[model samples]
Target chain A: MTADLLQQTIWLAAVLFAIGFIGLMVRRNMLFMLLSLELMLNAAALLFICGGAVWGQADGQVMFIIVLTVAGAEVAVGLGLLIQLQRRCKSLDIDRLSKMGETE
Target chain B: MSSDSLLSLLPLICISVTIMILMLQIVLVPGDRLSYWLTVIGVVATLWATFFITPLLPQQATILLTVDAEARLFSQILVICTLLLLPFCHRIPTARGSSAEYLLLLLLTLLGALVLASASHMAALVIGVELISLSLVVMIAYPFAPQYSTALETGIKYLLLSGVASAVLLFGAGLTYIGLGALEFSAISQAFTDIDLMEQGLVLSGLMMVIAAIGFKLSLAPFHLWTADLYQGAPLLSATVLATLAKAAMALALFRFYLAADLAVLQVINLGIALLAILSMLTGNLLALFQRDLRRIMAGSSIAHFGYLMVLLVAISTLHSVEGAAQSRALLAWVIYLVTYLAATLAVFSVMLHIAPASEAFHQTQLKGLCQRHPLSGWVLLLAMLSLAGIPLTAGFIGKFYIFTEAVNGTLWGLLLTLIAASAIGLFYYLKVVLMLISPAEGAEADPVTGRWLTRLPIILIALFIVFVGIYPPSLIDLLSQL
Candidate 1:
């Protein structure tokens, strides 16, 4: 029964990672990309909790807590940046970020 | 009862208190010069605390943190760099409404860096890394100038990349925990010895994942695409802090981790690092050659510098035959390199901030006639550029010489050759800046305004340190050897 639960958790993580990667690669919206990043972080935390359960150890759980903290910090900073970007460009499309290139 | 154990946490405590006080003051009192001065005092106090208390900590404090002489020394340098940045922050016309928030974030970033410097555990290390990253996001976007759209975009890039890196770090941590059932460095080292090859592979992958994330932070090749843009877009103060303090802290942490880990089983990863080093050197120097913007040029130079540092790191990983003197010498060389590199970079950035027009335009042409108008600032910048180019009679030359010497003794001849070639390419761009500063301007005279004395003082001090260290490096080397 534990094995089944573990498999299900792993599957969920895999799905989340896939979705996040697709969103990161395919989506042009910067906000969506950030959301996808959050999704990726959540998947990592889910994996950590599942791993902790399987190993019967608290290290993974402790790590999950840290991951949660990092995610929260990231969102706070990320959204602040998003607001600034929106104010400047009135849009958050990733494609418009050509200012990153050398010549630009 | 150990002095080291108690002293280890002093900087952290001082910084935390200072951050709280600064935040509270910002909330209560109106944002003004007083708040800025408070923040500067906070950073200075932290610097003193780092010097006085850090030396007392036990050489290696706990499984998660080390209070060794090396970490303390780097922490001291980082504190000084943060202090040097204060005046620049004050003088620069901040696009953001409140300079207080900028100062607050800068202090928090410093606190995070100090934590990372002493981190001996994976959890502590990750936390430190994230703390610095989160604060940097604010620093990068703090200048809300219309031209700062690029800065905002770069912040978003850093945000997303850092988030992914953290997740990768967690994933790696989870795998390592599953394999070794522990997060402590010493236990992980022990586990590597007892575990089977497959289990070892799992642990290795974990380390590599963390390294990848760190490489992004360090601006090493394949992960350095974000550096030039971010540095270019951010304010001069933000760029200097990111390039110097943040990179120094991360590099020191990585060095300690490599020392503690079972490096023997990680031969492939070390080799991969060497390859990346070469690529970064070639790419960074080559790309920097044509850059018109000063910030982009510095960004490219930083990438190349990291390449050289990585060479030293790769050598340290492989040189198991030499235990005491050789190892200590290599480590000392790296420490000295970091100190000298930070000083040179900060001095250069300080001069750039002074010369930059109030209009916030940073084009190369703006630097014209600088030598005629402000001879002192021009000379300081000239010295800084020469030092960065590793010209004779400068700190950078000595640092590179020591690193290459170590690389040669370690038999990393190929990397050493590439390093020399890259340094030559780097010289062109550094000289280009010097040329711009010295060359006569066509129409307008350079701004006659001497920058703030507080700002000018640090630039002179850093320049003096560069020359002193360049001429006589033995004392600094001796101090680093004790680490």
Candidate 2:
């Protein structure tokens, strides 16, 4: 039963990771992209934990702590920059912020 | 965490002290002037510690972080970069934020890069990368003014893209651990040996994912869309940090990982990296051909150089089966290329630091008559361009010469031809800029040199160093072969 549970968790993590990866690419909204990034990060964290559980080792969980810390840092700065972006562009679409590319 | 092991981390500890004291000062008294000098002192102390204490390093500083000779060398480069950027660090003219906070973040970023330079395990890699990148996001967006929206916009783009990059890196790392049951780099060779490459597809896929992620960070082509935007948008000093320190640390980390992993069997990996090299060379040079913005042009030039670096990387991997002077030469080629690239980049960016006005809109035409206006800086930029173009009597030429020799040794003829063509395209734009600097402008006012001696000295000294190294590269070669 525990083996089935671990397998199920791994499958779920993979699904979420795919969803996040796709959403990050497909979404035009900046906020959605940030959310997708978070989703991907948490998915990795979930995989690390389950992988550790299967191996009966603690390194996976140890890695998760670092992942969590990184996630928090990213969110803190990402949102701050998001607010700044909103103020400047007055919109959340990434398409509008494409003025930086080389102009021929 | 023993006393002896603690001794090995003195440099890290010194930087941490710098961070703590800066934080305390910010809490007790915002806009503290003393923090600037404190940050400088901290970087110097860390350099001294890295130089003096690393020789007596403990056998292990833990599984996560260990001070190896390679790490020590990269650390020396990082500290020296920080030392050179100190003159600019003192005066950060911002809209709302204080320079104190800026200095704190700068030092923190350096600390993270130092960890990356020496990280032996996966955790330190993630942590160090995150720390450096997060600080960068804030530092890019820190100087918020009503007029300058480009910085904010670019910061958001970098934040989102870099965030996704970190997640990808983490996921890849996690998958690798699942396959190998170990996260330490030392375990890579053992895993490659034990597992059948065709069957354990997870391990290979996972490693490839990690490579892709790093390529994003390093701004390799196809993943390099953000390089020009970020370089053009960030403050000159911040751009310098991104171009020089962050990329060097990532390249060194990749070098260590590539050296450790078994790559002789994997033909696909080498070809893939070579393709990226070719793409980067084409994209970087072609994009720069049309750019009127000086910052954007440098951005493109950096991309081309990264492509050149990748050729050396492929050479190293192709020659991985051997363990002799050939192997060392491959490594030496990449390091020499990296070193000369950094020096030339620093010279260019430092000149930009003085030339670009408060609004940060850098037009190529503004460089006209710079030689007549501010002869010292104009000449420095001129020399920097020559070196960057790999022209004769420049450090870049020697670096490229060594790279060409190694490419032949590895027999990467296709990449060699591509690199040669890129350098040809590279020379045109580089000369265009040089011509812009020396020639007189139509109606522009005379832009005099305004910065103090502290900043000017480094730019001139670095330009001179480029020339010196170009003339006598044997010394550097001898030193590299010793390494």
Candidate 3:
């Protein structure tokens, strides 16, 4: 029963990862892309918790906590930056930030 | 059990204490320079502590952290770089007002990076990485100017990317733990030997994802898009720190992690890394060629340099010869390359800060008539640029020589060729900067900016070190081999 649950969790994480990857590739809006990234992180967190439970070890759980702390810090800094970007460019289009061009 | 092991931890403790004192001082005395002095004293003390403890460190201290000679060497380099960077924060107009706050963030970042240099476990690695990243966010956005929106944007992009990378890292850690049932690097290595190929694949994937996350931090090719904007937008002092110190720490962490992993597994990742290195080299150099902004040019060049460092990584990964001498040579080459790269980069940025106007425009025009107006600064810039371009008798050339020699000795002929070609391409832009320095000003008068002793001291020291290392790299090579 526990193995079945672990397998289910892995499948769910795979699904979430696929969804996030799709959103990252398809979304033109920067905000949506960022949201997609957050989804991917959430999937990773879920995977970590499930792995810890399945393995019955504290390492995965410790890593999960570390990931959570990093995630929180990242959001704080990233959102702050986004606000500044929005103020300057007036739009959050990721595609438009190609001012530093491939050749230039 | 040994006194050496306890003594080895002094630098970390000193830095921690310094940070606490500075934090307390900031709260106690709102407008005093005590916090600044304490921070400077802290960095210097850390440097001194690194020197004193180097002899007492055990061959290999613990699972979570190592006190090996290599780690000690790198720690000292980091502390000295931090010390040199302190006074520039004072002269750099943009980093004013919150000087104490900036110093605190820098010290914290240094602490984290020092930990990263010594990290021997996945847990320590994760903690060290996040600590540095958090402090970096604050430093990047510290400039309160209205135009600092770019800094804010850069910070946000870094935050999001870093977040994704951390999650990826955690997932990798989870997979590794499941496969090996241990978080210790030594245990993981032992477990890999017993694991079947199919299980190895899963563990390899986890390692790859973790490498990708670190690749983002290092700004390697596919992961490099955020660097230019961030460098351009960040305050010059913070940008210098980011370009030199932070990247070095990330590289060191990745190097150590790879060292602990199985070579066969690492071989599987080499193809992808080679491609990334080649792409970063070509793209970085090519993009830098037409850049009008000096900061962007440095950013592009940095990407190219990272490519060179990746060449060393690829060599270290694939070379399986059991000859300890050959391995030590490779390690020595890597250390020399890092030290030379750090010095050359710091010298260039220091000169940039010296010459830059109050507005910090960093346009090519601002550098007009530099040779005529400030001969000393011009010569320093020229020497640094030449070194960066890997010219003979410069530290850059010696560093590149060692790396390429190792690559050739390891018979990575294709990678060696790529490095050579990319370096040839890189020469154009380094020359471009030099040309701009020597070119006559069209209409605008050259602005004279005199720097204080504290500001000039680091640049001069770095300049002399570059020359000394270039001419006598064997001394460093010998020191590294003893480690």
> Chain A TM-score for model 1, please?
0.85
Q: lDDT, candidate 2, residue B449?
A: 58
lDDT of 2 by residue, B374-416 (tens): 8888898999999999988999999889889999988889999
Chain A TM-score values for every predicted structure, listed in order: 0.85, 0.85, 0.83
> Which sequence of candidate numbers ranks them by TM-score, best first?
2, 1, 3
TM-score of chain B of 1: 0.94
lDDT (10s digit) by residue, model 2, range A19-45: 998999899898898899899999999
Which is the winner by DockQ between candidate 2 and candidate 3? 2
Report the Cα lDDT for candidate 1.
0.78
TM-score, B chain alone, candidates in order: 0.94, 0.95, 0.94
Q: Using lDDT as the measure, what is the rank order of every candidate, best first?
A: 2, 1, 3
Q: What's the lDDT for all of these models? A: 0.78, 0.82, 0.77
Q: Which 10-residue window in model 2 chain B sums to the lowest lDDT?
A: B144-153
Candidate 2 Cα outliers beyond 4 Å, as residue runs: A1-11, A86-104, B144-147, B196-199, B262-265
Model 2, residue B100: C-alpha shift (Å):
1.0
Worst 10 residues of 3 chain B by lDDT: B144-153
